[model samples]
Structures are given as C-alpha cells and as structure tokens.
Target: MFSKSKCFVGGQIWSQTTRRITKWLKEVKSSTIRETQLQPTCSSPVYCYGPLLHTVQTAEPKLFKDSKTFVDMRMIHSQSETLDTFNKLMEKTEGKPSHEELKQFVNKNFESGNELENATLSDWKENPKFLEKIKDPVLRQFASDLNQIWPGLARQIRPHVIENPTQYSIEPVPNKFVVPGGRFMEPYYWDSYWIISGLLICEMPDTARGVIENFLWFVEKYGFVPNGGRVYYAERSQPPLLASMVDLYIKYTNDTKWLKDNIDTLEKELKYWLNVHTVDVNGNTLLRYYAPSAGPRPESYREDLETAKGNQALYTELKSGAESGWDFSSRWFADTDGSLNSIQVTNIVPVDLNAFYCGAVEHISNFYSILGNDKKSAEWKNIRDEFRESIYKVLWSEEDGIWFDVNITTGEKRKQFYPSNVSPLWTKCIGQNQNMVEVGDRVAKYVSQSDMFYYPGGIPTSSNRAGEQWDFPNAWPPLQGIMVEGLANSESQMAQQLSFNLTERWVRSNLRGFRDTNEMFEKYDCEVPGRYGGGGEYVVQSGFGWTNGVILEMLNAHGDELTADED
Candidate 1:
C-alpha cells in the first residue's frame, strides 16, 4: 500500500456555559452524522480506526516520535496476518506487551520507513518561460530552484497498495501528484490549489491535471474529498478548494470538455459541504469547518491525547481545528492565555471557510454557464448571491473595517487581527451591493494600519504570539498567498502596492532562507528573514509544496519589478 521513497518523521476544557455549548455541539454532530450517512464513505481497515492502529499509535515510548509513522507503515504481509500476529502478541503478554516487544513486532510486520516514494515528474522543464520574466539573475536562479523542487516532491502510491489495500493507510491515486514535502507525503486537500498553480506556471499542465483528477477520484469514491490522501483523514476535510483547483486548471488549459465531464462531481463535492458543514446564524445559513470524528488524530495521536487529557469533546475540537488547516492557532482558542486546551473551533464561523464557499459556488456557476446549462448556472448563481448576502450580513464588520469570524454559539464577532479576516476580499465575497473600489480602499487602509506591516519578512498569520506555527512570528506560504492575492486583485492602488510589498518580502525571505539553508521551508520565521519557522508538533519541514507554489506565483506576478540586490 506504500511506495519506497525517503523517510522523514514528524485541546480541551469545560464550563456551565459548557452545558449549553456541549448540547449544541451534540445536536450539530447528530445532524452532520445523519447528513454524512446518506453518502458512501471510503472506509479503511486500519487507518481510520482498528485495534492494530490503536495499540501501535498509543504504545508507550511511542513506536515513532511522530505517530503518523506507524500508521503510514506498509505491512510486510497481508493485513489479516499482521493483525493476527499483533493480537497473538497482545494475548501472550496479557495485553501488556513491553514497549520494546511492541516495537519489535511492528518492525517485523511493517515497512521500516515512510509509505510514499519520490516520483519523478516526466513533464518537468528546467527553464520555464515564466522565469525569463525575471531580469535579476539571483532571483531567476532562486525561482529556477523552486521550479526544480516539483519532481522531488511528486509521489504515487505503490502498485501493491491497489492489490493489498488493507495493508496501507494511503488512498491510492491513479496518477503521480506533488506532495507538501517533509513528512506530508500524501496529497492534501487545499495545498493542491497552490501546487497546481505553481505547476501550471512551470508549464507542467499535465502534472497539474493529474492532481486535479486525483481529487475528482476522491469525490467520486468518498462522496467528498478527505483532508488528505489517507484513510485516517476520511472523516475530516481541509478547505473546500476542489472547485478552485478546477478553475485554475481551466484557466491554464481551456479544457471546457473536461469541465463538462466533471461538473457533476464538482457539484456533488460542493453539496457535501453545504449539507454537512453548514450552520445557522440568526436564521441565515453559512458554512463552518467541522470534523465529526472521535479520538485523537491517528497522525498526531500522542500530542492530541496529552493535550486533550482524556476529554473527548476537546479531542473533537482539536480535530476540527486541524480541519481548518490552522491547527493550534490562537484564532481557535477560547481563552486569553492561548492554551491548546481552550481551543473551540466548532463555535466559530470562520471567515475564510465561508469566503471559500462563496468562491466555490461562483466558480461552479461559471462552469455551468460555460457548459451552456443556463438553468443550473442561474441556480448556482442564485446560491452564490444568497451565500454572499449571508456572509455580508453575518461576517462583515463595517465598524472594524474588515470581516470577522462570528461565533455561531454566541452570535458575536471575533474581531481579531487574523490574516483570514481579509479572506472575503480574497474571495471577492463583499456582497452584491457594496462598491468594490470603496470596500477595497477601506480594507487596504485597514490592513496598512494593522500590525501585519510590522513584519519585515512577511505577514504573520495572526497578531497573537501564541507560540503556535499559525500564530505570530511564523509566516506561512498559504496565508501570504491569500493576503497578496486579495490585495493585488483589489481596485485600490494602495492595496495593490501593499500586495507587492508583501510579495517582495516573502520572496526575499524564501530566497534568503534557501540561500542560507539550501532548502525551501514549509513556514518561515517572519521576524527573521533567513530563518525557517518553528513551533507546533514537529520539526520545521523542508521541500515544502505550497512554499514553492507561493514564491513561484509571486515571481510570475511581479518578476519584472523584483530585484535580488541587497535591501
């Protein structure tokens, strides 16, 4: 079920208001479960849940520092044989096997390293025409290096995985796809959007098309895409960017026939979110990120267990936070201390999630329009209009000069300085009545006046220095892409300049970090230009997918103006 490649290893609380919160959460979970039950789910024997998984992930001293390592191991024999051996060992030791004994059993039965092998890209081009736009040799070389990273991060499931499905956690895809390197071996949900964009820029549309097709395969098999290409992530999903990826692919390829073929699947995926993840806010329906699952994440079993401290509700919240793609951020914490235990991701109606929905529906509407389905096109357009209206009524804050995530539980706005607060601008979900120019100008000024500009390297994910990777001092590539795209697309000149400035800083930091370390990091220390980011569950990753994508996107957008001369 795995390929032979390289090996890299990688919430909670209560209250009296807790009673009402708990009750609401239960109702929400019940409703979501019922909705999900109507659809076919691609369940795995060992990845999502099972005795073998539980024993290994929770084993004392841990089989691997990163719990994902154990789940990712391919079995040497059939899964039933492996499980029988494990159960026999447990019975022999009366369910109290020594850590070493368990370790030995695992080593004997499973592959010793990561499940995904490095896949070479047949479409990789050494010099893309996009790079010729860069006048500066230093910047062009850096951009070239980023382009070269594509093949190394490409991965495909082993053929044995298809023959022996139960022997692995990885969901098999028919084609090779790029991964966000350094322990993130499988293809992720939203990361593919940027990866595909970068691939197209590198003149690798075939590779980009393959990744999109993999996601389409997921929607067909699972009725929705999982958070990543693993069974453990089946119950959860990251940002709803499948349609966005489709949009990007069409722009680069102009493949209307492909859109016609896959439009139904896209609608099915969108309906999954609309049916399962939507919530009510004062009678208006909006979307929120929710992962209706139990137990600590198999990938992060130990860390989630210790943080939750046996609280199942807390575990669920942690998983939901992870589903938001900003796991362990202060933006999700309910307390002022920024404690992991205080995370309340379910209560909050995230601005970015809703904005993404808005964008997705609009794209779907356009897809239908292109396919000459005027009736369905009009229907999706109406849905988009209604959703945009709800977002404007519920999430926008004229007083604060930006949109905010509203707490569905309390009906109060979370008026924090999060990069996501500007997502509506990015998604262009600023309501049908609002003037784009006026709104863009105001939002641009708001951003210009915020603490984001204080970071010389790039925009921090949030103003809070919560010691989480998604918090202060850490600037992630995806967040940078969001802010830059949001502002650059605006009618406000100041906003466009701010976008360019942020773009320049991010590209410089990535370039400097690559120059110093000879690597492209997953996240960077926004406070230190050349340093890689550190915080959260594991060591900072390298050969990152989105990082390379964002930098290449920036280079493509502003290559003529950007210079590599010492600032």
Candidate 2:
C-alpha cells in the first residue's frame, strides 16, 4: 500500500540498521545481543512494533538465539520513523534547517537560564543583604545589570577561605577559580591585576586571593610571570601590578604570616627587576621593561626590527629592572659603543609604573617593620624616598603642567599626552602650589575636548586620530575607574566633573551598544559612538571581567552621587 519512494526510504533505513548490527556483531564476536540487555523504553517507539516484533516472534529457537537480528530490525524501524519525521519537518519548512527557529524552541525550553530573567536588577535591589554589602543604589543597580550581562562574574570575583592550601603561589589553572577568559589570556598578567580590583569591591575576596596566589605561584615557578602560561607567551608581560595585588590581598586577609612567608620571594622578584631588567650605566639605573618595540601587537615578541614602529613607541622599553614577568623588558640591540645592551628607553617613564613602584617600596618597608626587621625596613624606606624624589624631579614637566616620564639618562621628558600622566595623582606624590591644579586642568581639558580624548562614551587611550590610541577614544573601565578615585584624592572640582561626564557617557554607550548587539564588547570605539573594536581571536564578549567589575565598584564608590564622592 505504500508508495515506491516510501518503500525505498524504509528499505534504506533497514539496510543502515542491518549494517550497524553486523558491525556490532563483528565487534562482539562470540557474545549474543541477549548478553547486552537493551532497555524496553528505548529512544524510539517504532522499534518496539516493527521488524523487532517479527524477529522476536519467530518460532525457531535458533532465530531467537541471535538476538542481534531483533536489535538490528528495531534500530531500522526507529531510524526510519525518525527520518520520516525529519522529512515532514523539512517539507513544512521548504528544506530550510530552521536553525533560528530551533534555537528559539530550545531557548524557550531553557528560559530559566536567561540571566536577565533569572537575576533581574529589580530583584538585586530588593535584596537587603546585597544592599548592605553595597550601600550605593547606583552601584547595586550597576552590579545587578552586570550580573544580567555576565551572570557568574560577581560570584567568581568574591574572596573565599583557603584551608590547608598549598604554598602561597599562583596556579595557572586553579581547581576552584577559572577566569572566564581562560588560558588564552596568559600574557595579560598585569591586566588581570587591574581586573582583580573589581572583584575585591564585589566582596569576592576568595577569587581575588586565588588570582594573587596564582600569580605568586607563577613568580615562584618561573622567576617572573610571562605574558601568559603558554610557551609562545614567554617573552613579554603587561604593566606590572604585583605589588598592588599584594597590597589588596593583604588588606582583605590581614594575614601577616602570608606576607612574611612570601617576603623572600617578593624581594627576589624586586631584585630580578633591579639586576636583570634594569641596566646600570654611569651609576644610574635605567628601566628596560618592555620588548619587541611594537605597540599592542597580539604576539608578545617583537615582529619588526626598527624598535617601536607605531603607537608601540608610546610605551617605554625597560631593559633590566622588571620585578615580575609582567614588568617591561628593553628591546634588544647593539648600542653605539658596539656593546650588546638592553635599551631601557620607553615611550614614557609612565607615571603609573613609577607610582606603583614607589607604593611597592613603601609596602615592603611596612611589611619589614611589622616583622621587626627594622634594618631592612629602613633600607627599603630610603630607597622608596629616593625613587619618589626621582619621579618628581625627572618626570615632572612644569611647562606642560603635567608630570611625564623622562629618559632618566638623557633627562628629556616624554612629550606624550596620555592618561598615565594622571596616575601620579593617585600616589599623592604631586606637591602643593599649582601642580595638582595644572594636572587636574589637563585631565578636564582632555575629558571635555571632542576631537581628542573625549568621545561619546568615555576617554580614548590616545588623541592623535592618525596615531595608535590604546586608550584613545576607547574608554577602558579600569583606567576611568582609577582616575575617578585619583581625582577624588586630588580634590579637584574639574576632575570630579570629568569623572562624572565619562561615567555617564560609559553607561549610555554601554546601553546603546548592548541594545544594538546583545553583548558587552571588550572595547568600544567611542569615536564611532556605538561600534566595538580591538578584539583579537576570541569572539570578544561575555568574559569582560575588568569592565564589568570596575564599573560596578566605581559606581559603588561614587554612591548616590555618580559624579562627586569624596570617599
């Protein structure tokens, strides 16, 4: 009664099932299908009634002896039924796969998994516990929204209790904490440090500690943490934030023993910077930190010969004095003296690095004092004070009203307009007079300017539209967030306005970008208003740890006033 085509399809299904059974029988040589108990309620229903019934209802025991026949027949019928249903669906859709429609179907079935639906901002706001932990409603709202964007970010950021743990070290891949970005981000060691601040603010101390421990593990294992754990990532690291991360960890844990236990390792890291990374020429220590002399290239090593081809020139070349793998290394070359030298010259001395190093020395001194190592503490203090003096004298440019990095040997100030100049303010190293005011004014000007630093969303990395702008037009949440705090410290009214303007722009841009594309990109091309750029390899969304974390914390720090919060 069936049509020729139906018979042909059924015959094909039967043949396929027969072949499968034959293969199975060959594999299970002596064993019968009966030995392998098949469930009655299999995936398909047609198997119960079709060819299987015929094979099982046979009178001869020999026919029943090889249960493989029954099993194969059942599989044939089940497959045919499935094929028929698929064919019917295809007919209805005119042979289209219906991928989108199917996705909708699956999503509907798993509607509960939707982040916004599950953890609505309204729900977070209503939670008294969350409100108590994060007193600011704006911050709470921001966190709730971020949760909607990336659900596990907040939980992954919280600090946890480590009991009976291994030595205080960094694990490339922690059993408990997995950075959402994964192993691909091995080269971004210092970047992770900046991202950790957001986690700390979220009360995710465990996650923060785990990240620190992992870095320490890296330091203990490899002398310095490379840009990443992969072999290819061994060459370069991002900006060094080891000391800052240590400070944060100490603040949260208050574990003096942890500091004491790791002080030797920390000191070793510092020594590595001094002896290996920095070069001593004419009694002055010149920093040689970064390598390959190219700006923001994906590959850690230098791709070209002529040292800093483009925007990469904006960064300094610290040849010898990197304390951590994340510290900069100098480009390799032969000096005019015909001697192999690691060139420590950088795009600038970088206000941030100097400030961070100063802070590190101070922390080291404090730790030593606490440990009753007065001699060591005093030694470190003297070094710290000297570095502070150098930072002020060498990096400050009175003409520009901004503190810039100087080629320590040449004594020429790096004439670059970058956010790094704002970092010294964070360290409170800028003295009185109009120094703070001048720096604040410059930052304010950059914020208000439309063609350069100012964009629809936030401050850009660099202003030269033609030049490579790492921070230009692309408002990095971490930098913006830090500046907000730094501005508060300076108590500059203009700085406050700049911070508020940038924050509001970011929120607006984020909303607009998300609306257009249902994800938060790594960096937004603020110049274009809604476009996102600068993502390499990965599908640059989802695991935006720093952006989500920093923004939430910054908003919280600002409290009800998203602009001017002294605290």
Question: Deviation in angstroms for 449 in model 2?
Answer: 7.3
- Give the Cα lDDT of each candidate: 0.82, 0.47
Tens-digit lDDT track of model 1 for 332-397: 888635699988888889999999989999999999988899877876777788788888989988
Off by over 4 Å in 1: 1-45, 113-115
Q: List, residue by residue over 302-356, the lDDT tens digit for candidate 2.
A: 2211233432222223211231221222111112122112334332245666666
What is the TM-score of candidate 1? Answer: 0.92
Clash count per candidate:
2, 50
Model 1: which ten-residue window has the lowest total lDDT?
9-18
Q: Evaluated with lDDT, which candidate comes out highest?
A: 1
Worst 10 residues of 2 by lDDT: 111-120
